[model samples]
Target: MSIQLIHAMNDLTATHKDLLELSKRKTEALTNNKLDEFQALLLEEQKLIRQLEKQEQKRQEAAEAWKDEQHHPAETLTITEILGRLDVEEQKMAEDAAVALTDTIRELKRQEHLNKALLEESMKFVQLSMELVNPSIQSMNYGTASSDKMSGRSLFDSKA
Candidate 1:
């Protein structure tokens, strides 16, 4: 395996694990009324997701290049016929690659969407489970607020 490919795969897996941890953090933060931390972790996860996507793109590019090389025109021919025949085969191969890339891009995009949804659903389950366990830790309002003046603001608001 390519060093870059290996690193990319490792990074992607690490990022996914980080995202899972962030989801857990969000659940805890919401339970403890620390919405700020929850939002911060969510943002970090989003950033990591974007990075992971970029790495995926790079991997795809490398794979496409390898496929292109594999379909190169057959070696050896009459010196005169070589250039013309090579051009034809190269064009055919390129067209084939274009079609393959389009299909693969669509499929990968769909998979990415599904992965996002799965993570979101998992987070929802976490939040719901926390609710079930404590039953009073709070919903989305965090810990609740006093009725005093300048109160009832978002949980993210400064306490001091």
Candidate 2:
């Protein structure tokens, strides 16, 4: 059971590393404004995320099974708690797997944050471009109070 738990943790770590790589590529795609590449990365990311979720579920189940076998009284058990019941060799493996997974997930979060900021900036740029291309007449008006009263009139009077 401990072995199963360790295996699940290792699998999760591997998947997380792959996701981190994808995140790096996505950041590059966003930076370069490669819409097609970005879209492809998004699809790949989704697939990985689904796989990660399944791995997480399996890890949880393994942990639960270990807890049951060990006769742990707690309704829920953490990896650290489970580690206490493991032998020295298994403890080391689980610890290493957990640490690696944690580090990779942290890095992935940082990369995702950067990507989000880039996307927001891109959206702002597109909005600015659209406004420039089709600015409202009200926005074009920069007149004093008296001129403001002639709101509906054309800027240039043909009869003048």
The per-model lDDT (C-alpha) reads 0.56, 0.91
Clashes of each: 0, 0
Model 1 scores worst on lDDT over the 10 consecutive residues at 76-85
**In candidate 2, residue 28 scores what lDDT?**
93
Residue 126 in candidate 1, Cα distance off native in Å: 18
TM-scores of all predicted structures = 0.40, 0.88
Give a tens-digit lDDT track for model 1, residues 41-148: 778878977987887787655544433554535343222332233356554544454445445445545545655675577789989998888776444344435334
Give the poorly placed runs of model 2, Cα more than 4 Å off: 142-146, 149-160
Candidate 2 lands at a TM-score of 0.88
